[model samples]
Target: MAKDDLVSIDGKVSSLSGGGVYYITLENGVDISAKLCGKMKKFKIKVVVGDRVTVGMSPYDPTHGLILHRHKF
Candidate 1:
């Protein structure tokens, strides 16, 4: 999909679910279900609860997204 088609949001991981899924709470107070993207898995990046991350969401389905990047600081 084109980058323009996805909306990026900054959020903190709230919890983990079955099958390596994560629940993220967005800055604007929305909670979305997220999963690590392919690149993160390929690079062996680890994501845990309470971590800040960037998620790419689709407007049509704002309740779920792909965790595209993690913020370490």
Candidate 2:
């Protein structure tokens, strides 16, 4: 789906899995798996466990998403 069609939400990285997969816990207490998007990969942005991040996903699939942005605070 297109980027504009994605639903964005804020979450915290809970764990890192093999194969570049990250598990994030959303603000509402839901966990979802996500991966880095193209720009993030190209720029080599690092996301470790406990970092807050923004995830973008299709409304139809809430269990998976793209790690769009990392929040620094």
Candidate 3:
């Protein structure tokens, strides 16, 4: 699917796991696994528990997504 076809959602980092995977809790209370995007990895962005982040995922699969951006506030 094209980038535009992906849905972006706001969530908070709930836990860290091996292989750079993270569990994020969405606004509706569901948790999904995500991985840092290349831009964030290249910039060395760190995401810890309780940090708000923006996730991009396909509408068909909400269980996994890419960590697109980190919220400053």
TM-score of each: 0.93, 0.97, 0.92
Error of 2 at 54 (Å): 0.3
Regions more than 4 Å wrong, model 3: none
Estimate, for each residue in 10-31, the C-alpha lDDT of model 2 and write its tens digit. Answer: 9999999999999999999999
Give the clashing pairs for model 2: none
Task: Give the Cα error of residue 27 in candidate 2, in Å.
Answer: 0.3
Which candidate gets the maximum TM-score versus the true structure?
A: 2
The regions of model 1 sitting more than 4 angstroms off are none
Clashes of 3: 0
Q: Candidate 2 versus the native: TM-score?
A: 0.97
Candidate 3 at 21: error in angstroms?
0.3
Order of candidate numbers by TM-score, starting with the best: 2, 1, 3
Ten-residue segment with the worst summed lDDT in candidate 2?
57-66
TM-score of 1: 0.93
